[model samples]
Target chain A: MTDLLRVVDPGLYTTVQDLGRPHAISSGVPPGGAMDRFAHSAANLLVGNDIGAATLECTLIGPRLVAEAPCLVAVTGADCELLINARPAPMWSGIFLSTGDELHFGARRSGARMHIAVSGGVAADRWLGSLSTNVIAGRGGMHGRPLMSGDVIAAVAERSGPGVSGRELDPHLRPDYSNHTLGVIAGPHMKRLDADGRAALLGSTFHVSRDADRMGYRLDGATLRAAGDELLSFGLVAGALQVPGGGQPILLMADHQTAGGYPVVAVVVSASMAIAAQLVPGDEVRFEETTIEAALRVRRERRAALDSLRS
Target chain B: MPPPRSTTRVRIHPLGDTALLAELGTRLDTALNTRAIALAAALKKRRDVRQAVAGYATVTVHFDPDQTTHEALGSAIKRLATKRPPMEEPGRLHRIPVVYDGPDLESVAGALGLQPQAVAEIHTRPIYRVFLVGFVPGWAYLGPLPEELAMPRRDVPRTLVPAGSVAIAGRQTGIYPLATPGGWHLIGRTSVKLFLPDSDPPSLFRAGDRVKFFGVRP
Candidate 1:
């Protein structure tokens, strides 16, 4: 392994994440990974790394790092200004940094999380076959927690020769983090919601409440009245919109619990997950009902876009 | 007594493009749970499936969208369900020792109109089934809690329920593997660690395991 970068200033809640441990979910482990998978993969691709390569997922704020060795790096997700050696640098494209060069982030423009990928991927402790951090379980990633000052980040493999840089993802391929409307499919418990509740789900405009985090986004909107009877607890997936007795709806996210008891009214489609990840507290969001075929088609389209970048 | 054979028809619904939630039944019957667990295990072997998690009476199969579609997976699940896979051998049994000294012991007994000792006696009577393990890492939801001991969850959940605190809520009993906010009525504590991150199969309990709780002096 080659030491690549040193965390000079750990930003707010920065952790190493990749594609995540999907198989571990049966063991009650949450599928904790990069909230914005598209950006995470794009950043990895820009750095000539595999889509599943571990990268830094910075929340709200970004980190300041000093290069320990020559490495290629790329940043994606969140409209944050990048600075290299105190000079402005462009995002969505690969850049090379020499030893002793510093990287910094300035001014959050849009979105909540930013992903940074380095050549050869960031090497860290892995748990359940993943480097993604599950903070609740206190395992995986860097000791199951976010980065701290003075922490040394190493590359999984050493750069053998001069690495390629300046690879850029087409602007059209980038997701619109600004999009507020999300496509959703009706959940099994949709009937539990009263007619008004069902109508509100499609007609209402909700705002992301302050309680938003990796676990879920509690939305502040119309009071949805669902049946009071408690449903049997069941396995929950990210993007499930669960409405509790309180009438408020919560959108489950990447770090959500393995199972839940609340009635899930609808689930956001896979294609809209990146947009959902970019949402911050107080962001306005609306839901639109869509068919299964439409949801799958959009997801396929998104995957095709990513695949296009691969070739 | 072993749970009766599940006679309910299975229903499949779309969780999303990537997953399908199959409901075997509504109530928390052991028979339904067993079938769900069996179905989940069977589905996990499929090349198209990423993971299949069993709930009380449901199995949520997460699949690779590129490899399979909802209709295709739905039919596969139906075909598997029709076979009615025989219940496998009962999982490992755990006889956990617990000291029945908890903050809610008296209150829970009072609510049930029974003595604290009587409540503990009823709580330990049956060999509870581990229906599912979830809500958090290593946290197993066990029961069909005895009808006599059935008590509603506390109206106001505690801000922090200590790890290893054995608690009961509705028809289920569980031990908190981590200190977290909870609403269950805590009636005992266990020395056994349910969560061991470094160990393979980190959780001490798995779905379909058998658990028997016995009272012990502090």
Candidate 2:
């Protein structure tokens, strides 16, 4: 069986993603890939692909899939009403689609990101060992951009036992992306802010702006004053909550640029990133301060839970 | 010889269940940055550590939630931060060829009361160091442009700044790795590819590296 699926309708922001580009920031490559890397991995595992196999990442809306051959596919993350050949398709269940079968994903009413995994994985070229799309540089994925209407994606033809049965994300772990209360740790420049600035960060509610993207989420909320004088440009991380002169906090995300100079007030932990990924424009989010030790402990527990899913 | 062991201030915070934030103080000269890089590398060496997010003067260590706790990781990191050994080697350095003819070149020259050639000469006088890479992929923020050449970013960022377009802001010079919207004063362009996914290294430069600019034509 040839490993390819013709794209009939590329959804709003569909891109091929695996883990992401790692250890290349110095050369100026942002670690670009799925905003929801955890779900991306889970979907790939459910479909029996290697842990880091290339999978199609759909956000909000999903694209139409036309199977060119017999294949096994599974959808996870946000719930989406899926249909095959106009028949309702069960989510989180690995199902077989024959040649000429068409899969359709409609507008998403809930959840921010959805992952679709095909048996044998999506047949795509790997750049730096990933098929994820990086739009800013226009490289990787199906031609280094979102899948548009009329694009074709090949899958790694299945040649063995039936794919693993699908599974659901832990109910407790089900992220509340719509209304996220992200817990933040103090940033390097957190001390620069006066008492009022510190109070502003922990006290006010911030709205995710429409400008939010894989690069960074520009927030609109109370102005967080710097603790001290101006800071020279410095390194920045994915979760670094930087407040520019405007006082708005820009939460960096996957595909974020490598460095920044803004005064950072906080950094979100990995456990909360899944929830962070689900945030859409106009969503309300608040930052709760926590000690670094508490954050790491939470991350350790979450990792164990993910491992248990396979066993 | 190693410089005197200077006092480095670092703040520890929580990102979530999987990561810890290590914010280095403003005086993150060479010694403090070395300590930060070593800690980040050590964290990356762990099987459970997923990613390490480092900002200008901070590093956030991301781990698998099952294997480690935020408290445990933070404790481990703080211990390492305490007078740890300096990092071995810094990152690689790169020389980029650019054409010093950006849209904002003239205005920038006028702001400094010098000709565009003089502006370019002043800008290229020093081999700028890579402070960090952010705002976009492969877009390195090379710093401390000659004080005279310092200028503010465009009041209104252009809808599109072609890839490889070189620009400058107050005390900083950089190149646009790809075509996207930007506000930096455009002074020139470069054909040298700064980012390539298919390549083994992928990016033309990384953080902690030094960059020198040479004028190139279309």
Candidate 3:
């Protein structure tokens, strides 16, 4: 058996994603792809699929799969309930399936987005060197929309002969989505804010508002007053918590626009981004301020962990 | 939170592996933004940096993880922080001809307490520098309009301000690169394509470009 499964149950929101498009920002196009890049990559590697393969960006609920041939698959990122023909399938583990077997993912137990990678990847047309879906522009990834109840996606053609079986990622590599604390690095405007503004930013507890999406996550918390009035328009990136006129902080995410004019309080660090991706609306988030040194150290440790798995 | 400062200081932070996020400073102006962009570019040139990403008042530096740790990269950046150079003078001048006949022209002139011709004269009197490109692709946020000509933005933004529309907000003027929703007061229109996505230099104006306007004949 060379290929994999077809979608029998397309849950809440599932879209295909790869690394994302980078060069399109200057044209008012956002670089959108997988929210959890590390998790996506790990899942792909587990199934022996190429790192850039089109994987499923499953939201609160994941899709159901029916195998058409024997194939290996793995799930990474947030903990979600999984079942095989009504029997439970464990999260964060690799499994094999034969033709006619069924796999279904239930409501999320923790986290927002999950990654499901099959051995040969999802067969979809590539645009701008990625299969990531961009719903705003209505392009790429399964006709630029979320998966529905009855979608049948064909498996991609295999490049390497089917000689390897899927393996599970090291248990330690799994992210703890239940944790609300995230690390951040001080930004250029840190000097602009006064001591109290800075203190309040780090000490406060912010709830992820229901308005959160791939574009950005709006927070409901102690109003964060800007040090100055309006600001000049500048570039924006993911993890930026921009406070506009209302003083509410909005954290930009993977599908964020290339530029913005809101004053940011702090930026989420790289290592904690996977955790950020798992945040759902109403999830509580508290920022644990760290020096640039701490943020970087965290990143290095995470990378080292990932490297060890690959080796 | 402390008593709000009269002038807001926008926060800037490094977003790992991707880009920088510059929290917008208070009263988005041309001068501070110019300093921010140039400083970001300069700060990026120092040791072990990969890319210099600037926005508003914050700049993020992206580097290769294999070459260095994020800690080393951040400390290296903090050491390099310093005052930015004066806004770099524009390399070249672009004289764009604009037809002073937008729908909002009359209201804008009245708000500035000047006749339509006087407003036009004030607009064309001084050459402006292109501070930065943002809001939409190729949109040029041009600057330092004569204080007398400076006007508040329209309470209701146009749903679709045509491409090439010359508009003004408090202390600044700009050319819309494409047809998009805008809140600036429109005074005229131009035919120059400020942004061409397919072109080599997608943006017509860089951070350090100069611009002058002329009254075009229909």
| Candidate number with greatest TM-score | 1
Q: Which parts of model 1 have CA positions greater than 4 angstroms off?
A: A159-162, B1-8
Better of 1 and 2 by TM-score: 1
**What TM-score, over all chains together, does every model reach?**
0.97, 0.83, 0.77
List, residue by residue over B144-179, the lDDT tens digit for candidate 3: 788998877888778898888999998889988777
lDDT, model 1: 0.89
lDDT of 3 by residue, A157-236 (tens): 66333434445566666656678898876654555567777787788889999989998888998877777656666666
lDDT of 3 at A297: 71
How far in Å is the alpha carbon of A48 misplaced in model 3? Answer: 1.8
Candidate 1 chain A has its poorest 10 consecutive residues by lDDT at A157-166
Sorted on TM-score, best first, the list reads 1, 2, 3
Worst 10 residues of 2 chain B by lDDT: B3-12
In model 3, which runs have C-alpha deviations exceeding 4 angstroms? A1-10, A23-28, A64-70, A97-103, A123-130, A139-166, B1-50, B54-59, B69-106, B115-130, B135-138, B144-148, B154-166, B175-182, B186-218
Task: Please give, for residues B31-150, the per-residue lDDT of candidate 2 as tens digits.
Answer: 555566566767778787777745555675766766876667777776766755664575676777778888888998887789999987877788776656555656766776888888
Order candidates by lDDT, high to low. Answer: 1, 2, 3
Docking class of 1: medium
